[model samples]
Target chain A: MHPAPSVIIFTALSGLGFGLMAWLGFGLPAVSGWSAFTFFFVAYALAVGGLVASTFHLGNPKRAIKAFSQWRSSWLSREGVLAIVSLLVIAVYAIGVIFLNQRWQIAGWAGALLSLGTVFTTSMIYAQMKTVPRWNTPLTPVLFFLYALAGGALLAGQTGAAIMLLIVLCSVQVLAWVLGENSFARAGHTIETATGLGNLGRVRLLESPHSGPNYLLKEMVYIVGRKHAHKLRVIAIFLMGLVPVAILTLLPTNHYMAAIAVLSHMAGLFVSRWLFFAQAEHVVGLYYDKR
Target chain B: MTSLPQSTQKKLGLAIDLDTCVGCHACVISCKEWNTSNYGSPLSDMDAYGAEPSGTFLNRIHTYEAKTLERAAQVVHFPKSCLHCEDAPCVTVCPTGASYKRSEDGIVLVNEDDCMGCGLCAWACPYGAREMDVAEGVMKKCTLCVDRIYNENIPEEDRVPSCVRTCPAGARHFGDFADPDSNVSILSAERGGFALMAEQGTNPVNRYLPPRPKADISGSGQIGVPATALGEETGGAKGFLSWLDKALEKI
Candidate 1:
């Protein structure tokens, strides 16, 4: 599939934003009163901003409300509805934190659940496309959830508990990346079948339908050389996974280094997300005459 | 609220035979000829004389080799257009409701005037069947020659799609698939027709019959006749006769 930059940015940023929300909402109530307020405000802002950025993906942004009507069958609809619901829950939680002193605890718990729901919904948007076997696996949603939590924990206030959370999150991220890579390899066979070939044997392009380029070729046939893809994969695993974990575990307990690790993780995730789209060969790619 | 009876409905579809298909691409040409003049506006060719000339084609022939080992393999020509899937992802994803499936005949169609050219329907489709009409600012696809198929002025037997009629090898067949006794349904069953990308669960109405097997072309390795078959050389006369026989054998 051709990587839509808007969508790539949306998914990656939302994973971070929602992941941060999940960790903060779940952890804030345990923290001291003043510290809880500060964490909640920052996490909520990220989540809301990420959700707003996602709206730019729609071709006709005004008709986005229609997306909610097909939630019964369409994952995209469910995602939109769930995002709205999560936003509403966060709003109520913020109100409770500011004024509704009696319901603060109850609202915080709701906020935590809503944050997790947002992550699941976001993951399901890709996970439901069974045609793309790489995205269809149960691991896809699990990885998204893990990535969100990891990103969130990394961004949360740099306390001792926060450092421990970051370490655990990074471990899960590495595990998910390994599993995701395997899933992609398996998916290659299915994509070969989708092109009307009878077997998994090598299928090379002999001709292209268009002269210069067409929309289908531009969108589906994203060419990432094997060597470059390997290099990027290693960088993603190290910077996003190992480096963050190592900094949290081995480095001196300094807030600046922890924050820098978080920034590096985000940067690594941007590259990883680009690979995620670039490496995905849509079945339509077969028609473009370039394997 | 009122509901329509299901028994009155029909499922129309096309049955394509891969075995007899000659790969002449006549169906594609006929489809372009019919749809361009009849359906809506002409499928304009941007520049016939210029460096880049492009136009809308409702149908196209995609030739491929199915599991071959030879250098010049046997090719399977797939005449592709809209499958007019029962699920019709393109219809459901249309934000404007301009694209829809006919409840009566199961024909998926686009309303050119109502389309806003959002291109979401094209993205939703896995088959890449839909294409944007740049001149009209709307999406277009195979209508199954709706204008020609139902024309009252034409004779009943001749009222089928132009592609079906123009197919020289009789590879294309069109009919109502809802009826069990329909020609398309029967042919599909007998031939064990397969849907492209069945894993996608699009439930495409059009089906492609598998190509029939051909004889093996591998050569067998063997030597010439034995040396003992040659007569013995006794003397000058006999040797001369043997030489003569050898020359006759060579001839």
Candidate 2:
């Protein structure tokens, strides 16, 4: 919930990159070898580069290779495994299409699906967190995938699909914020329940767990005021959806407009991604009376 | 082997008595002292003797003032640590095979050797129990004093967790809950002990005994008619107020 810079960069960049990769596999923006090569390079840079950025947050980045061993139960492990396998599959598909000028239908389709799976795994890393009730909903994955698809379509030069997805994702993002605001309405406990003083009466935290920042408070108790969140949401929607859609719709063929649209969209997405982490309320924060 | 053991031999855990704990933080200090030199690496301090000092600690005593409609406010010293849950999300979420729950005693532990210190397990755990030791680049948590509990070098009486052994008020209990007649099990049964955040579905082995309710003391000489205030109303309203005044001598 800290809105860690490295993780935010990773999720945003990789979502774009994998989105591009999936669209490339789906045979959008048919281009010659050199153009395809450029797209692949950008896609890999965003996907793999975003991945490398993720290591910066690790306490011991050197031992990350061991993370792949526990895929049976851990979503993080599955994400790592899926990323590697998807990159490999995408690599083969890229070579087949760019070098040999052959579609390799099986490789193309498989690569596309796996790239989506890789992004899904990434989203699942947060979506599965029961500690953050706002993110522990079926809507988390849906929003993540929609964002990826919207950004991917725009990056792929598929304005038609990009416009459609941007509209949907923006709507969902607003919905998510609304739902998230009331996420804890049906929480299993109150402060009274947490302290086992329910029968006694209402309970309030008169003393904090600690005065200074502890690991739990620092990491899990992130809070964003409702007014600031609303303003940011408006900015995100205007830039991510309205402006880009307007640009794509009004100047359907202007390369400058398209470039401006993509830049605005990505920037807006970065802000929302930050809010996603900032607004997440971890249940442990309840223990500190911070939630 | 992140998969949990199908049949754990013992459910070794702590049973905290909320009624008796004094919030002295002795258990916290004792845990830090014993664990800093034991099975794991030193629990590193960011600024040990500086203006802003902080460190990784497995056990922490959270003191809360509970104000209830039924009684006056009561201060509850809740010492929290790893509960070693039956369905521990911490162990399952560890990407590396570092976090695991032992089949022998059902105590969840982090194998510092393999831990990459990604901090995902800390996120997975609902209780805020685990702490990532940035200095050692590994997650640290309550091992239930795994090293001391099984060590023959220590005296048999001191083989329990350092927190349990150091609690002066006898509030911390250490025992195997698998045995129906274990001290912890009996204490839970008799005191109506309940698990913290049972709805989280972790099935934590540890229990907290809620403080027994007393006469409603929302106002008055604390309790309206304390035994000490008895036979005072017979004198009249003025005399009763005087008797209540006598009870407020400590104020």
B87-130, model 1: which lDDT tens digit per residue?
77676655445677887887888877556554656656666687
Candidate 1 chain A minimal-lDDT segment of 10 residues = A200-209
Name model 2 segments beyond 4 Å from true: A224-227, B215-232, B235-251
How does residue A171 of candidate 2 score in lDDT? 92
Best-matching candidate per lDDT: 2
lDDT per residue (tens digit) for residues A32-120 in model 1: 44555666676666666676766665434565555566555555556667777766776676665555543455655676677788789
| Interface RMSD, per-candidate values to 1 decimal | 5.1, 1.5
Interface RMSD of 2: 1.5
Pairs that collide in candidate 1 are A2-A219, A19-A148, A20-A152
DockQ of each: 0.19, 0.60
TM-score of 2: 0.94
Model 2: per-residue lDDT, tens digit, A1-291? 888999999999998999998999888877649889988998999999989989988998889999999999899999999999999998998997789887776787788899899999999999888778888888988987998789999989998899999999999999998988877656565666566766656666666655556777777887755349878888989988999999988875777888899899988998899899988888887778777
Candidates in order, TM-scores: namely: 0.76, 0.94
